[model samples]
Target: MQPAMRSLSPLTPSDYHAHGVCCCGTPLLQHFHERMMALFAGLHGPETVSASPRGQDSPLLLTNLRLFDGSGAPLRDNVAVRVMEGRIQAILPGDAEPEGAEMIDCGGRVLMPGLIDAHWHTTLAAITQAAAMTADVGYVHLVAAREAERTLMRGVTSVRDVGGPAFALKRAIDEGIVAGPRIFPAGAMISQTSGHGDFRMRHEVPRGATTPLTEQERQGVAAIADGEAEVLRRTREQLMLGASQVKLMAGGGVASTYDPLDSTQFTERELRAGVQAADDWGTYVMVHVYTPRGIQRALRAGVRSIEHGQLADEESVRMMAGEGAWWSLQPFLQDEDSNLYPDAARRESQRQVAEGTVRAYEMAQRFNVNTAWGTDILFNPQNTPNQLRHLAKLTRFYDPLTALAMATGRNGELLSLSGPRNPYPGTLGRIEPGALADLLVVDGDPSQNLDFLADPARHMRLIMKSGRIHKDRL
Candidate 1:
């Protein structure tokens, strides 16, 4: 069952690093070659034991487990889940065993929906800031591929990528060429000149009408647009590039050097342009803004999601509640997971955001705003392992069950805002029949001991995404 062979040239590690395994330096073909080679060797070959069946279309039965359906419902016992064709087929009683199905005894563990990150930067999170700006885009994507595999191992099966050039990575994951979470990509973060998404040097200012786009912009990392027309064009370009949603910068950011934290970036007219473009394509716009003025302006222009509104005043929170907008909050507390900034100005801004995070959670709770959780870990490979710790930090504001539910069901709600542009289709973030098969079976009851999430390697007994088991310790 092998193909024709040829005398292949030998390559060194540095050759592999510089030119990649396939040498063309494209993630798709590189990953595809690796995956196909593995398959040709009998799915992990004669050396290691493959955990579970690689065929996603096969039927899978999980038995003897307590269920946290991610629906904010009470835990149920004595039930088994049936998965078929990458979707939940039924929730049967414990004694009902179907014929000709692969079964895994859960050993009385707890099964819950896999975690969903509402605000994530796929291609930008794991690499250092310096490397991301200067490294080869192909090399950057290879790093992202590794990070994406780690992300799945953390029990996160899906993410709403708010910014970054994640389209190619998404395609690789979808094609089974790589092991990663489902990505709902917003191709780029659109911003005006000197705004938050502008990662240009100070000497590169004074962009004339004929100035060429920066390297970042050319790579679909971020787009710098000035007026309404340009904003409209950029928004459509992202959609044309298979963006599930559009992300626009509406305020200053802590990471950017030129803009102050309180300065609003986009005007209402410009914001309206992006929103309308996304709306025409049956998707919504999510904006990056922190201050009240910026948040209110984005809401006035029909933005559906508000990202990082920690510094928002009570009035702005009220407006978000009135408009029924999704509040995508992240654990930005000045902790070990916080990004390191050398300058005092950025450090001061980080401190202010940390202080506002507590009050922002309180306001969202008080006003009944739809809140979702994420770990906006950027450019820090050392802190990337703290992704689950960020979710566990939600317990500081809510109980264990509530915090887990926020990462599962609540975040799933926010991702569904991308109406027809939803890439994976079917219901997600739930354990009922007809939902996508993304479940995690852990050692203990997370309802009582949320610490199980802090160490997924030893605690997670089994991990399944789209009816295919990626890891199995049972």
Candidate 2:
């Protein structure tokens, strides 16, 4: 389903100048300004040596390594990879050297494809809920900018951003004005009133015909719509905003305030409206849902991915497999990596999700479903460092190799559902010829011991995205 190519580049004013017209107050000018602000937002960090920019024309080689190609196969020794123009050119013998290439010695470390976070919130991961709701938009973007660099240093080279105002962040990273993972952005989360994405408080209920959108909605964190027409409009708006895929809230959520855990959201017709909108744009819809009824409704409406289906039953899981849907699961074990709750109801909801987490994984495996892994860390900066720890937690249900593959290759496969909207147009999530060069050199083999991933600051010796070295301590 590959469609015509689309540009991820920020808009320039050449058209206006060519036509002898002023570019003030134009969408292109606004977008250009957003990119500039995103670049300036990242200026708070301490000065350090930066790597020279490498584009499609750069020739680089990584040699002397044990390789885990992220294909779920056993590790291989004495292999080297040649990368040029930001993609893997060839896999050669460890001792083979080519002329006119910048070589990086791996020193017998483990070289593997860089990690991919299937369900991430680029603008919402690090900030607290209170800060996110009350802080200035520019301040929020600045915090997200610093977190983006930290996320890359954690060895996550790409992320499927399910929701938030990540368009500017993605543009800045793509332009090389800021350092971050390659972002496949789902512009905003669309939700019905009182649905999972709704952030309205008790006092703001009984919305009028012309009531203004909530603050969170205005910031692109979520969009609240009702009925088929409204849902279709909201879905198309996200697609028009450069969303690779669209996210809709099909059920209740723990982080949200009003919705109960058992509530089923978005009627079949409402969801179908969203599905039709995304499908027309050559992409698909992914929904945040966790109940049997919600899952069934979404699947019936042709949703391609189900996120956070921890509370699903066997029937729901079987239906998911039969429909060939992707299960984007997370390790919500209610331990160090989970977000803390202040109220009793939310805590009870957390316990239920934790209790169902392992069973959900087991069911997906039993049904042979297309399962992927992610760390849905939101509004918890302290737990964000435990992102890799969540991947390690997957070892409870699968072996180390299987767990690693879920985050690398399997997650990459799920991200490709964006089709034409895919910003970085190339193969990802595997160490093979013709794939994008997003890789990591680990101090130890994660295939044998997944614990190496839990401490990226110590074990991640080298990190590369698009064949350019982002962190090299080798």
TM-score of each: 0.90, 0.90
For model 2, what is the C-alpha lDDT against the true structure? 0.85
- Candidate 1: the clashing residue pairs are none
Give per-residue CA lDDT, model 1, range 177-224, as digits (tens).
Answer: 667899999998999988999988877878887988899999988999
Identify the candidate with maximal lDDT.
Answer: 2
lDDT of 2 by residue, 18-60 (tens): 3333457697876666555545434322212124444246677
Off by over 4 Å in 2: 1-50, 54-56
Give candidate 1 misplaced runs (Cα > 4 Å).
1-51
lDDT, candidate 2, residue 208? 99
